[model samples]
Target: MQESSEVAGSIVSEDCLDEVIQEQIKTLKNAQTAALSAVTKRRNEIFRLMDNCDNLHLVKSEVIILCKLRDKYDESFQQYEKHLTDSSERNTVNKRHSENTASIDRFITEMNNWVKESELQLTADLDRKSLCSSSTTRTKSSRTSVRSARLKEKARLAELMAQHAMREKTKVMEEQELRLKQEREEQEFRLRKKKEQLELETKIAMSQARERVYAEADNISDIVPKDTPSPLNPNVDPFQPQPSDITVDTPQLKANVPCSSSHCRFPEPNLDMQLQSQQEMFLKTQQHMTAAMLLPSIEVPKFKGDPIEFATFMMAFDARIAPNASGDADKLYYLDQQLEGEAKDLIGGCLYMSSSEGYTSARSLLSQEYGDPYKVSMAYIKKLISWSALKHEDPHGLYTFALFLIKCRHAMTNLSHMEVLNHLPNLQAVVKKLPTYLQNKWCSLAGHLREEKGGVDFADLVEFVYRKAKAANDPTFSKFALQNNYSKP
Candidate 1:
C-alpha cells in the first residue's frame, strides 16, 4: 500500500513539473516573436530613411544607426534563445520524470494485482485447512474431548482464584475503612479538647480580675471607713443634705468575655497558598493510593518464566500461515491475535486496577491480568505512561511484556516519542542486555516507525534507537528497507 501510494504521488508531481515547463516554453516563444518583429520594423525604417537621403554622409549615418539597432535586436534574440533552451531542458527532464512515473505506476499496479490474487488464494487455503482440521478432529473425537476437558479445568481454576482475590480485596477495604474512621474520631476529639482548654483559660483570667477588684474595695473600706460613707444607708437618705451624698465614682473594670467557637470569626485563608497545598496534597495522596493499590496485584503465570510468549505466539502463527499466499493468511491471523491481546488488555487492566486495593493489588499486574482478567494491561498503561512521565519507574518484566502491544499498527500510530522516551531510562537498560540481532531488529523497527510518516509521529525515543541500529548495521534494516517508500498520509 505504501509503495503504491508513493509511486502515485511521484507521478502527480512529475505531471505538475511538466505543466510548468510547458508554460515557460510558451512564454519564451512569445518573447522571441516580439523581438523578431521589432528587429524587422527597425531595419525597414532604417532602409527607407537611407533611400530618402541622397548624401553619402546621411546614408552612412543611417547605416551606423541601423547597425546599433541590429545589435540591440541580436542581444534580445540571444536572451530569448537562452530562455528557449532552458525551457527545452526543463521539458526533457519533465518527460524523463513522466516516463519514470509511468514505469513505477505499472510496477505498483502489477504488485497490487499480485497481492490481491495472493490474498484470495490465501483465503481459499485457510478454508481448506479448516476443513482438513475439522475432518481430522472428527477422526480423533476422543482427543478433542480430552483437550476440551483440560481447558475447562484450567478455566475453573482461574475463576476460583479470581473469586478468592475479590474476597481478599473486600476484607482489606473493610480494614482500611475502619482505620480511617478511627483516625477521624481521634482528630475530632483533639480539636474538641483544644477548644475547651482555650475557653477555660479565658474564664480563669476573667475570675482573677474580678477577685482583684473585690480585694481593692475591701481594703478601701478597712482603711477609711470613718471618712467613707456607709455601704447602703448613705445613698438611701436622699433627704439628708450631707456632703458625702455627692461622692465621686471610681473607674470600673470591664470583665473578659469568652468567645464561642460557633460564632468566632476566623481570618480567611490565603487562596494561592491554600490552593497550592491542596494540589500538592492531592497529588501526593493520589500517587500514594495508586501505588498502594497496585502493590497487591496477583502475579500473572508465565510460560516457564519466558517473557516472549506473545511474541513467540505471533511469530509461530505467522509461520503457520506464511506458505498460504504472500503471507496474507499469516498477517490476518496475527492481526486477529493482536486484536485479542488488545481487548484483553483493556478488560484485564481495569480489573487489575480494581483488584489492587488490597493484597491482590500488590502482586504482579501481568499475572493478575492473565489469570483473573485474562486481558492485557499494556494498552492502558501505554495511554497513562504517555500522558504522565511517572509510568517509567521500576518498569519490570511486566513492562517489557507490554511491548507486545506495538504489533497493533493503528495503536502505534497514536503514540509519540516523548511518551516513549519518558521510559528511556528503563528501555535503555533492557536494550543493552538484549542480543545484538534483537537490538538491531528493534532499531530497524524504530527507524521504520520514525520514517513512516516522514518522521515518527508517535514517539521520539526510537530516533535514538534508529541511530544505534544504524551504527550497529542491523540486518532488519538493509538499504532496500531504508529506500522503500511508505504510503502517503
Candidate 2:
C-alpha cells in the first residue's frame, strides 16, 4: 500500500511544473510582439515625416512633428524597460535584453534633442529669409514707379520746347515778308514820280521848240521884203532930141560912079517913088521880125528963135522922110526946100527910112504923105551894109544897121527886082563880134529875114559867121558856134 501512494504524488507534481512554464513563455512572446510592432510604427512615422518635408515645406512645423514622434518612441521604450525589470521577468533567460533597452533609450534621447534643435534653427532661418524677400520686392517696385514718372516729365518738357521754337520761326518769317512788301511799295512810288517828272520836262522842251520856230519865222519875215523891183533903169531918156551934127556923110566918089553891068546898076531914087515902093514892100513882109514899132510922123509946130528948138525941128524932118515922101519928084523937092540944111542932110544920111503911117505915101509939096515912099530904101540899106564892112565900126553901129536892114526887108519883100545884097556881109561880121548869147539874138534876126525875104542868101552869111567864130579869141563864142552850127547866120 505505501508504494502506490508515493507514485501517485510524483505524477501530480510533474503536471503542475509543466503548466507554469507554458504561461511564462506566453508572456515573453507577447512582449516581444509588442516591441516589434512599436518599432515598425515608429519607422513608418519617420518615413512619413521625411516625405512631407522634401523641399523644406513648412520646415518649422515639420521639425516640431518629428520631436513629438521622438518623445512618443521614448515613452514606449521606458514601458518596455519596466516590463523587463520585474522579478519573474528578471530571472527569465532573455538574452541581450538590457543592451537592446539601452540602445532603444539612447536612440530615443538623440532623436528628441535633434528634433528640438531642428525646430528652433528652422524657425529662425524662415523668419530671416521672409524679411530679406519682402525688402527686395519693395526696392524693385520703387524703381519701376520712379522710372515711369521721369518718362512723363521728359515728354512734357520736350513738347513745350518744340512749340516755342515753331512760334519764334513763324514770327521771324512774317516780319521779313512785311519788310519786303514795304520796300516794293517804296520802289513803285519812286518810279511813278520819276515818270511824271520826265513827262513834264518833255512837255516844256516841246513848247520851247515850237516857240523858237515861230520866232525864227518872224525874224526871217522881217529881214527880207517880198515885192521890190530890181533897181537899175532911171538914167535912160528915149525922147531926147538929137543934135544937128549927127549926120552921115556920103562920099562924092561913090555917088557919081557909073555901073559896070546891068546887075550892078540902080535907078536914081526920088523920095516920093522910094517911099511908095518901100511902104508896099514893108506891108507884105511885116510878119517876119517886129522887134521895134516905128512911131508915126506928125507936123512940127513953128517955134521961133531957139537953136535947140531948131535942132529938134530938124530931127522931126529927118524922122518924117519915109512918111512925107511923094510919088511926084517936084512935090518932094518942094518938101525938101521947107527943111533947114541940117534937117535935109540928116534925111539923106538915113540907110533905112521908116513910114510913120501904115501905107505908101502920095505926091507931095508941103502936103504930107503917110508911109514909106521909096523903093531905093532897100538899095540904101544895101549900101549902108557894104559901108559897115569897110569901116572898122563898133558892134553897136552894126546892130543898128541890122535893125535898119530888117525894116528895109519888111518894106520890099514883095518886089521881084528888089534885092538886099549888101546887108549879109555886115550882119555876118556883127554876129562874129558878138558873144555866143548875142549870136543867138542875131540868129533870131536871120530867121526873121528868111521868113520875110523867102530867098535870103543866108548860107554864105552863116558860113562866114562860123569861120569868124572859129578863128576868134573868145572861147564861149567858139564853143557855142561849134555845138550849134545850124543856128548861126
What lDDT does candidate 2 reach at residue 291?
A: 19
TM-score of 1: 0.20
Q: How does residue 132 of candidate 2 score in lDDT?
A: 82
TM-score of 2: 0.22
User: Per-residue lDDT of 1-489 in model 1, one digit per residue for the tens?
Assistant: 999999999999999998997787677657655655664565555445433323334444545554565455456545545554467765764565356446434643543454456556667878999998888857797888889999999999999999999999999999999999999788667656755655565456555555665566566445432433334576565676656757788764333433333433333334455445545654565456445443533332223212224444435434544344354333333333343444334334333233324213322343443423112234434443453221222223223433432432233344333244335554554455444555677777767865785543223433443444354443445433444433323
Compose the digit string of candidate 2's lDDT tens values, residues 101-137: 5655675566556566666777888899999888987
Quote the positional error of residue 467 for candidate 1 in Å.
36
Q: Each model's TM-score, in the order given?
A: 0.20, 0.22
Off by over 4 Å in 2: 47-95, 140-489
- The C-alpha RMSD of each candidate to the native structure, in angstroms, is 41.0, 65.3
